[model samples]
Target: MRWPAKLPAGTLNRSIMSAMDVFPTLAEAAGVEIDSPFELNGRSLWKALRDGKREPRKDWLMFASETPIRGHFNVTAFNDEWKLVQEIDQGLLGADVRTHLFQIEPDPNEHNNVAAAHPDVVEEIGEAIHRWRMLYPVSGTRHELVPPPGWRAPKDWAGYPVAVGDLQDEPAPGMPPPFALPTLDWQHGEAGRLIYDCEPYAFLGGGLCK
Candidate 1:
């Protein structure tokens, strides 16, 4: 909480919050107007911070990736009570996904596998995750942890790094342009491909090639 903003101190809020909430919360606190084409994923927590009490979680479903880094993803979906985790191996093909479920409110450490006991919950959450994932544009975000045969960081992070605005719009070294994409088989040839066999139906014919 910002000191000048007068947000309360020493507040224990049980509300489940995602990093995404920071944007909306801070923007509202700063009195910044937000204009978006669609509804935002997060909400302002300014009220809860002021009250310093257990805040009701407004967001019911949240998706996560980049646990510590990209390529290897420990994707999690959860609400206030139930938490679902998928250990994804972002290797070459990246098809396998191991799911783990826990009643987060009770077992925050996630010691037990309650998935078998709660088939309905698993199906419900899993289906929601699938639908949410389907919203991805399919133009990017390929999972690849195994470094290529020969590759090294171009520059050190503490040294030189390209900003998003300074980055080139051109595709990577061997990436094909959009016009030529429809004819190519993304599965075999493309360097940037999403997890194997996981692409949506539109991606089959390179219609949604990254």
Candidate 2:
């Protein structure tokens, strides 16, 4: 489906598209080469979404580039095929990050563990968490937003922090340790924070770090 033209000013959403599917659509619409999958930095994309720095372009396609942090994604009208879309980098702290995508099905049994407070709130939280995972792969370790012994929820669930601890059977060679998922507590108004004591994993993509 095409993205809503009237979404909130800076809202971000995730989509599941294969390279074969998105490439031609972008090519036909924008006359740009989508012949190959391009490498992108997760941190740069994240910051772009976090801050509203979108640029409108012709060919119904938009592109944004960040220096030394090359990466790109796509967007399209709700009904049209996905088009190559790029977000402007905001130079946020987590710049140059890479992400993995995963699936998250709902679990009724795990309802008690969430601090949604209200049923609707719980559902919203669940969707957010699920989307987060779908967009980025978990490090296998669950991270918590609340620091140890001081469990406080973040403000507006703005940041859903997850934990990553030392785990074996890495996904890629030289992969960093996985972090745990962060908890979302709406009551305390505490935005989640991902706690990783070590350096972030290096992202691989075209013109990514060059």
Misplaced by over 4 Å in model 1 are: 58-61, 64-73, 88-94, 137-139, 142-147, 151-210
Cα error, candidate 2, residue 152 (Å): 30
- Candidate 2 local lDDT, 1-210, one digit each (tens): 233452355464343223334444444434464344765321122222333344222122222223221122221111122221123222335423222121123432223223323445334433444454455433222242213212233333444542334322233332223332111211111222233333433233111111
Deviation in Å, model 1, residue 113 alpha carbon: 1.2
lDDT of 2 at 28: 43
Model 2 stretches astray by more than 4 angstroms: 1-29, 37-118, 124-131, 134-210
lDDT of 1 by residue, 89-192 (tens): 55566556788999987899999989999989888888877776677522234464443211123333463344333434444454555565444443333333
User: What does the lDDT read for residue 115 in candidate 2?
Assistant: 31
lDDT of 2 at 93: 52
lDDT at 14, model 2: 43
